[model samples]
Target chain A: MEKIVVVGLGLIGGSLALDLKKRGDFKVYGIDQNPTHVKKAIELGVIDAEISFSELSEADIVIIAVPVNIIPKLTQKVLDVVSNETLVFDVGSVKNEICKAVENHSKRKNFVAAHPLAGTEFSGPEAAILNLFDDKVNIICEADKTDWRILDKAISIFKKLNMRIKMMNPIEHDRHIAYVSHLSHVSSFMLGKTVLEIEKNEEAIFDMASTGFASTVRLAKSSANTWTPIFLENKDNIINSLNEYIKNLKEFKDLIENNNEEGLKESMNNTNYIKSILNGLK
Target chain B: MEKIVVVGLGLIGGSLALDLKKRGDFKVYGIDQNPTHVKKAIELGVIDAEISFSELSEADIVIIAVPVNIIPKLTQKVLDVVSNETLVFDVGSVKNEICKAVENHSKRKNFVAAHPLAGTEFSGPEAAILNLFDDKVNIICEADKTDWRILDKAISIFKKLNMRIKMMNPIEHDRHIAYVSHLSHVSSFMLGKTVLEIEKNEEAIFDMASTGFASTVRLAKSSANTWTPIFLENKDNIINSLNEYIKNLKEFKDLIENNNEEGLKESMNNTNYIKSILNGLK
Candidate 1:
């Protein structure tokens, strides 16, 4: 069996490993800098075996599922050790930094920038759920820079996982994701913080919190280790998105404070269009 | 059989009618100013029959499920016509206004101030579902102001629906709910508005928006009719929550803009406490 090496045995990597192993072709090797994750992943049967960085030379497929800040350097390190025929990809939220980091690598064509836009708020090996990637979007950036055969192999794998593939350039991918994904996390974390700060009685908050509050602040539960890097690495675009969000919030606050009922209703009605958009997504 | 009249046949009212009807001892009557809701509610079997507002005089249990701004007037009207033995309640998110409105009414002791603390994003009778109130929190504000036997009747009915009951004063209920429930809606609406503003290409957004964005923005699709009055009626408390939310967002924005990595990580870690809180709620 061909070896598929997965770095970072967290939610994304472990989940991908579990699903990929069920395909019954690749010998999945799980690797993580955190020994506990590596040990726990092995105990949970998330991988065929635990492997080391030096063992990557035999990997036919190398997937990096680390934090965004670690991805660029790790991608470079993997490319240095992997076989010439290996297909390498990094499943990081922010794409520009890693894509730019590998832009001038001699083995650029062997690497693909793949961000499988799938995850839950939970992380670590125990959160390795089956079918997590099924029916989710797998965004491939800089595919034109990858080897044709290698890209085809990656496509076949993603198709087997039941993912919808959309190809975009790195800049467009980063910008859109910064707005759609990263900014939402920032908003949720701050929302949770604000509520937790103001509501002194946790039980009172617990009693009053409806499905709406739970859902809106859900992403605030995302891993700090995973998200802190994303907000920083995608700082420019995320900051722009946050500024826009704050401006809209300020406008909403002013409207609410002044009892601008018309403006408030109008804005809410417009955003209700998201109902159709979300339905379409479903 | 006791007659139970539900005023305002929206999601909460309609769902409650369905569940209450299943309990097999009450004749449920649905009433709404919107004739369409009444008609659709009848078609959906969410009600036994449509009743006029004047019929509240004969009601054994009268529930005022209208918007917060209308609840004060509607509760007063219901109290005006309710029999001495009638148990009147208003399912409004903000309790202070309505509680205070009916405080001096001759039938004040007959009225229970309840906020069921349950709902889906969709609204209207069309959105009604069976068991929507199952295992949910039913917050009764100013229970002391209500008659002993009447509060007991409400508690028994809520118990039949499998809900947990909590009692709080009107002021505490409104203030805490402003933080937990109302502020989430504002944050979500602003999130949807922000993304909708920045991502001009809705198709791109539809593709890249993951579960996090979807969950965080889900409340953005809530009924404008239901929410406008809420934000306005709870203006003081809601604005306080909004201002705090905005302040947090600004602080987050500053951290990202200035590359304050430690602050970013610490904030996210702190907010991740919500994970445990949410898990506990489950």
Candidate 2:
């Protein structure tokens, strides 16, 4: 059986391992700096066993699912050890920096910069769920840079996971993701902070929080370890998105303050177009 | 059969009408200024028939489920026409205003100040669904002001609908809801508006928008007609919440700008308490 090695045995990594293992065609091994995660992943059957960095050359594929800040150096390190025939990829939210880091590497053609747009608020090995990437988007940034044979292998694996492939350059991926993904996390986290700060009575929040509040604030529960690095690595685009978000919020507040019913209705009506967009997503 | 007259044939009112009718004890009738909603409600079996405002006097129970801006006047009008023995209530998100509006009415004791913490981003009769209020919170404000017999009737009906009863004063209800409910809507709407403004490529948004973005921005799809009055009526408290929300967003932006990884993680970690809180909600 071909060996599939997954680094960073958290939700994404462990989940991918579980699904790939279910296919029953590959020996999936996990590596985590946290020994507890490696142990738990093994116990939970998220992976067949643990593997070391030195053993990477024997692996047919290596997947890096680490925090975005660590992805660049870790990708470089993985590429340095993996054989030229081995296909390697990193599943981090931000793409530009990692793509740029590997741009001039001699073995760059073996690396694929990918981001699977799938996850939940929970983290760690225990949070690993089956088919998390099924029918989800797998964005391959700088696809042109990867050798066609290697890229074909990566695409086939994503297809096996039932992911829709979309190709975009790294800069475009980061810019779009900043608005759709990173900004949502920031808005949700800040919302949770604002409510938690103001509502001294946790009981009130517990009793009064509707599904709407729960939905809007759901991302607030995401792992700080995973997101802090992403926000920093994608700081420029994220900052721009945040500026735009804050401006819109200030404008909304002004409309509410002035009781500009017409303006408020107009603004929200325009946004209601999202209903169609969201339905399309479904 | 007891006559249950629901004013405003939108999601909340229509759903309540449908559930009550499902029990086969009440002959539910709906009233809406929009002829389309009334027509739709009848066709969907959300209500047995349409009732005119003039016919409210014959109602054994009257539910005022109009927009928050209209609730005060509508509640007063409903009270004017309903019989002394009839129970009446207004289901508006803002409580203080409506409670205060009917405070001096001779029929004040007949009206229950209620904000059933239930609904969806969708509006109109078509959006109504069975069991929408199942296991949800039903916040009754100023219950002490409601007559014992009338309040008992209202409580019993809510129990039948499978809602958990929580009593809070109008001021507290408005304040808490501003944080937990109204503020979320504002944040979500602004998030949608921000993305729609910055990302001119709607196709990119459609492809890149993950479930996280969908959840966080879901409330942005809420009906403007339903929410405009709410934001305006509850402006003071919503404004307070918005200011705090914007403050947190700005602070978060500064942290990202400075690459304050520690600060960012700490902020998010603290906010992650929402996880336990949300888990409690479930």
Candidate 3:
């Protein structure tokens, strides 16, 4: 692609712009509602220039990396402006909403709904870094809805970024992601809230936070603006995941309450199976 | 300190042995119900030799680093066999039971109760490494019950390991640690369990586990042997923390269900305060 436009110059968008620009294969421009982010993206050399939505007409590729709540409308607007040959895709956490929003659009064939499963607790333009998408999984939902050429372009770009690709239906993608990714954020945030509520003395937390607590609560630091929409947009799956999580927590509580040492040991032993799964031993 | 006996040569005990041995100021010996750990500690140079409980009489310091359920009884046994000048201490996660168990002993003055707040997800003698306790906090409980000289010896040894000391009552320590340390473990394990249950394809978890999930679930990989007793021993505090944590999760769920965007944003915004707290931004 000769020209590319990255919307919402935040962690994913900014990082993509930086990497694409560094490769010298694409002329990268950024579009953000936040003027500060637009300015910072330029100052940080994340993009070659700032461009308006109208510039989508000249772009060979357009990437929407906005929050899930706004991704649908943004994707639609980009689709309206892009040329027939231009490939438009989103890096949203939730896929079903955006996929359905543009399913019937005239330029639907140009839009590919994608979710790149990679991020840190940090957010915003400055939080972006080089090669953030390297060796990560990029899930493309409803791939059949997009034209073959558009899908090929996205596959080529993501592969160039060293990402592995997987294809799934939008509904299935949302359900699985809600359990694995979104639920983790909820558990982490609540853990932080619970501990901070009880330990009013901040030094106690600072002194006692082992590597385990630090790692577990790291996601609690993620931006509220970024995650609120994700949890809200993917409400049904999130609620289901939350209900299951609460059930597990209650079962554990009951085991502890009854002093069922054997039962508690079994519960932990089963969960410790996570070690092998996480380590890819499974 | 001339000679030290480190009971239960697992992560904490083994790490302590390694640090002390590195100093070349003490001759550290090992004891564990697990012969594998005892043998490994010797092989890893974590201890100079493996010794029986009967050898406790020769040690100037007796460090009990066993699982919480075994700690109370083992601590009392160590106190019974140690010399009056010996500084005996238990590094169990929960401290109240161990403190109370030795409260009426004639040699109570020889015992110090401590919880060193440092560990990795891994376990056993093979998991031990040098300087694990460096700059970590060592919480000493019920110090007044112990002889001042014994307390001084305990403090000096931790200081030599480059650990800072904090003093608190066992009850307060248990309550606070249940929130900061214990709750994180439960949340992480449940997260791992929930994800593993929902995502039947283990490859999805391995492929999509970003830095956030990896860090958030890091504690789930910890040994069940160490954590099961901790959950049971500090059952009340853990239950209380879990209750609060579940309440927070439910509230978040409700907000998402109602599409109460403002509430979701506020809750996450409040929890985001952890960012500053964790980074010591304040």
TM-score each candidate. Answer: 0.98, 0.99, 0.97
Chain A only: TM-score of every candidate?
0.98, 0.98, 0.97
Q: Which ten residues in a row have the lowest lDDT in candidate 3 chain B?
A: B273-282
lDDT by residue (B50-154, candidate 2, tens digit) is 888899889999998898889998888889889999999888999899988999999999989888888888889999999889888899988888899999999
Deviation from native of the Cα of residue A205 in model 3, angstroms = 1.6
**Model 3 over residues A1-282: C-alpha lDDT tens digits?**
499999989998988889888864899999999999999999999999998887789999999998888999878888888899999989999988998899899999998888888888888999989888888889999888889988999998998888889998889888888888988899999998888887898888888886367778888989899999998888899999999999999988998899888887787788788778777421
Per-residue C-alpha lDDT of model 3 across residues B39-78, encoded as one tens digit per residue: 7788878899988888789999889998999988888888
Instruction: List the candidates ranked by TM-score, beginning with the highest.
Output: 2, 1, 3
- Model 1's CAPRI class is medium
Choose the strongest candidate by DockQ: 2
Candidate 3 wrong stretches, greater than 4 Å: A280-282, B280-282
Question: Could you give the CAPRI-style class of model 2?
Answer: high
- Candidate 3: fraction of native contacts reproduced: 0.81
The C-alpha stretches of model 1 lying farther than 4 A from their native spots are A280-282
- The alpha-carbon lDDT assigned to residue B146 of candidate 1 equals 85
